[model samples]
Target chain A: MKLLLRLKFLGTDFCGWQYQPNARTVQGTLTAAAREVFGTDCRITGCSRTDSGVHANDFAATLELPFADCPIPCARIPAAFAMRLPPDVSVTAASPVADDFHPRYTVLTKEYVYQILVSPVPDPFLYGRVWHYPKKLLPDAAARMNAVAAELVGRQDFASFMAAGSKITDTVRTVSDCRVQREGDLIILTIAADGFLYNMVRIIAGTLLLAGAGKLDRVGMRRIIDAKDRAAAGATAPPEGLYLNRVTYHE
Target chain B: MKLLLRLKFLGTDFCGWQYQPNARTVQGTLTAAAREVFGTDCRITGCSRTDSGVHANDFAATLELPFADCPIPCARIPAAFAMRLPPDVSVTAASPVADDFHPRYTVLTKEYVYQILVSPVPDPFLYGRVWHYPKKLLPDAAARMNAVAAELVGRQDFASFMAAGSKITDTVRTVSDCRVQREGDLIILTIAADGFLYNMVRIIAGTLLLAGAGKLDRVGMRRIIDAKDRAAAGATAPPEGLYLNRVTYHE
Candidate 1:
């Protein structure tokens, strides 16, 4: 039987979400824990590969239990598996799924939130959770970023925002929502898209920051998208401030 | 010259805010860091002692520089000292104060905030920062807690809320403000007082939680205070949920 699992992880100690041979990775840790619970024959597949230090509020995965009728109940799987997992990672929920269901290939939209802490002095409590950008965001930064973000919606080739060395050739994607807002001392940028290229969200965050910093304007943003070159876009923001917020599947 | 310093610490490590012979303590760490910045002869005194795992957002301390004329400017002290301190402990600000000013004495009021995350499952991001209470609070828990908190204000002998092993005999303290509020999934309790007995805030928090859980009532709260016995009040809450939010003094 196939099991769908929802995960939440801090990502501070792991290399990333994917499995690596030797390095400590989130998939590696979870796979190890699953092995201890259901033996070494269980097959696991993650929805996406997040960069090192990228957090996830809601991540999805699929697990293939080898036994015809596993003894562990679906409701109790998360709690039972959590005992073997480290504190940084936890399987929050689990459910049985169609035998052929795929977490990533399924059609739906994904949402991401990037956090920036605007402060003159460092905040000790939020040291690693946010990008502590000491520079003050322009008074009209949010408005300007929102204006530019609106231009990026709809179907388009997002090649400029893709990181270098990506093997995927199909760069066309659809961004359903892109907006920026300020909540107290934090600047939160949220984006929802059908699919994302490698480091697309990070590059979009960097580009929004540039507009906020007065380096990019609405026209400039449009021109960068049309350029279709990675160098045309702004730098990629750090992975620490990024979070995979939600993943929606077509019902 | 006497220097006043503002501090913020995570409090995940260290024994507490006081110096112990061989234990890892906040004062001991800060003292060692000061020695690196201002030599071994400098004297450092913290404003108050916090139990192990209690955080501080605005803790105060007094430092007596050994040299009659210290070379480091007051503005540069925070930066200089921060280099020698760990990421968890930061000297956020420093200033020259009156020669006779004291951190513990001559205080007008102090405020503390305690955080409790009311959720069945633990939040990985807030593991050590808040108390995870799995039970669902009563529908009128906030109002009930507020009622009990109101009874705690005013000048009174708070022997019922004091810890058992405290040496100080004076139990009279004045609570200026005591309130509770809920923000999202967190229930925050804020208390301001002219003075606090040993574990007073923790005990108050415990009693408030009991009231919220329907285990204690308004009459029970008054009765506990009138009893003037440490055992009359509810058990002390864990130190991790408490934070020294602010300390004030007469101008």
Candidate 2:
């Protein structure tokens, strides 16, 4: 049976989502747990390939079992997996899917959130969950960041935001929403799109950070987007502050 | 000179606030950093003693140096100490205080927050930060918890909530406020009081959790308090969900 799984993980101690021989990765951990629970090997496919230290609030994946049926009920799959999984990773939900359903190809929109801690002194509670900006942000930093983020909406070739040395030729993507907001000492940038390139969201977050620091304006953002050069954009933001928030599927 | 320091720490890896010979503790970690920054042995006093795995958002402490003067400015003390402190402990603010000022004897209120995650599935992002209740709470859990919490606001002999082995005879404390609020899947209980007994807040939180699950009501809460016996109250909640939120000193 083909099963759809919704998972969440704190990626601080993980190498990434993909399996590596010697390193500890989310895929490897889940695969081992699946092997323990099912008593056989299984194929696991993730919807997104996250970088190291990139968290996920709602990640989608598909699992193909060797048997025709699962002995455990669909609702109890998460509990069954919990016994073999570490505390840092959890399977929130699991259900049967179509035999041919693909976790990645059937997605509609993917949303990501980048968290920035704007404070002179770091917060110990948020040690590994945010990017600590030691310098004080400007008074209107969120407004400035939002102004620049609005310009990237709609379908566009986001070549400037993509990381360098990417082999993929296609850079055109549809950005449905982008927003920046502040709550207390934390500034959050949320972006949703049909798809993302290598380090695209991180680069966009870095550009927004520049805007928040009063170093970049709307005109500067537009110029960078039009240049279509990775060097024209800001530096790539750190992976710790990034989270894949949600993945929506078509009805 | 005596310096008042405001601090924050994630206590998941520490053995509480008091200094221990071999155990890793918040006070021991801060004392080492203080000695490194001040270049001599100094006396450190904390406002309250927290248990292991209890966090602090705004803890108060006082540092008394051996010398009469400090070369580094008061505003820069936090930065100076940051170099020696770990990422899980931070000194947020430092300021000059009267030589006779005491962190524990200050005449003001102390606020604490207890976080409860009400969900069937645990959240990996909130690991070691909240008490995960794996059962579904009543729909009006917050309102029900608040109704019982309001009964705790007043000067009363809270012997039922105090730990059984506490040596202190004075269990009477003035509670300024007690509130329960819900934000999404998190149910937060905030309480302010002149002082707290050993395990007072944890016991109260456990009793409130019973109320949230529809097992206890306002009448039950009143009965427990009036009993004035430690066994009359619910079990003490785990320390991970408790936080020292704030300490307000008299001007």
Candidate 3:
């Protein structure tokens, strides 16, 4: 039977989501926990790969249980996994899925949020969760960022915003929604897309920050997209400010 | 010269606010950082004493510098202290203060907030920031808790809620406001008082938790206050869920 699990993690102590030799990764830790609960031969697959120090409010994964008569109940799976996982990682929910359902292959939109702190006073509580940019943005910068973000919607090639050093040739993807807003001391940038390229969200965040700072404008964003060159865009923002918010499945 | 600083700390790694021999305390760390910027002979006084693992959003402190010609400028004091302090502790603001000013004695009101997570699923991000109570509270429990908390307002001898082992004989204090509100998955208990006894807020939070669970009520709260015995109230809640929200003084 296939099991679907919803997970949340701080990601500060993790190398990334994928399993890597001689490194501490979220997948490696979850796999170890899964092995302890579902035996050593269990199969585990993560829906999305995140960079180091990137947090996730909601992440999905799939696990294949070999035993049909597993003693662990569906609702009790989270509790059982919680015992084996570290305090920084938590399995929030678990349920049985169809045999053909894949965590990644299910066509749906994925949401990501990037948080930036704009206060001169540093917050010790949000140390690793937000990018502390002490500089003040131009007045009405949030609206300008939102205006620029709206240009990315619809199916288009986003090669200029993609990070370099990727072997995949296709850079075309459908962006559903993009929003920029301010909440208290935080500037939140949320983007939803059918798919994302390597470091695409981070690059977009970096570019929006530039626009908010008045260094770039909406016309500049259009030019960058037309150029289709990675060098034409702003630098990639740090992973600590990024959070994988949600992943919706069609079925 | 005297200087005042607005401080913030996570308090997760500290023993408490007071300085102790061979122990990691917020006072000890702050003093060490103070000495680094204001010479070794400087004296530091904290506004309030917080228990171990209790966070602070806005704590005030007064520092007496022995040298009038200190190299660090007044505006640069926070930055200098920031360099010497850990990431978990920060000096948000620094300014000159009158020689007669005192952080504790000159205070008007102190506000504290206790957070309780009312969810079956645990939150990894708020693990150390809130009390995780998986049990469902009785309906209208927040209003009941508030009704009970209202009894704490006004001047009264709160010996029953105070923890034992303090040498101070006086237990009379004035509570200006006590509120209980729910925000999404968190039930926040905010209290503002002229003074607080040792472990007073924690005990109140504990008694309110009982009230929310239908084990106690407003009548029980009045009786607890009237008894004036240390053992009359509920158990002291854990320190991790408490936060010293603000310290306001009449200038």
lDDT of each: 0.87, 0.92, 0.88
Task: TM-score chain B for all models.
Answer: 0.96, 0.98, 0.94
Single out the weakest 10-residue window by summed lDDT for candidate 2 chain B: B65-74
Q: Once model 1 is optimally superposed onto the true structure by TM-score, how far is the C-alpha of residue B117 displaced, in angstroms?
A: 2.1
lDDT of 1 by residue, B130-227 (tens): 88786789977877888888999899999999999998899999999999988877889999999899999999998899989988887899899999
Please tell me which model should have the higher TM-score, number 1 or number 2.
2
Sequence-dependent TM-score of model 3? 0.95
In model 1, where do residues sit more than 4 Å from their true spots? A32-41, A66-84, A135-139, B20-24, B31-42, B65-84, B135-139
RMSD, one per candidate, in order: 2.9, 1.9, 2.0
Interface RMSD, per-candidate values to 1 decimal: 2.2, 1.3, 1.7
Q: For candidate 3, lDDT tens digit of each residue in B19-80?
A: 99999988899899887776676788999888899999999998888766556777777778
Candidate 3 regions off by >4 Å?
Answer: A38-41, B38-41, B67-76
> Can you write out model 3's per-residue Cα lDDT over A1-251, one digit (the tens) per residue?
88999999998889989999999998999999999987756778888889999999999999888877556988888878877888788898998998899999894989999998887556889989998886789877888899899989989999998889887699999999999998888889999999899999999999998989988887999999999999999989999999999999997
| Among all candidates shown, the one with the greatest DockQ | 2
By lDDT rank, best first, the candidates go: 2, 3, 1
lDDT of 1 by residue, A171-229 (tens): 99999999998887788999999999999999999998998888899899999999999
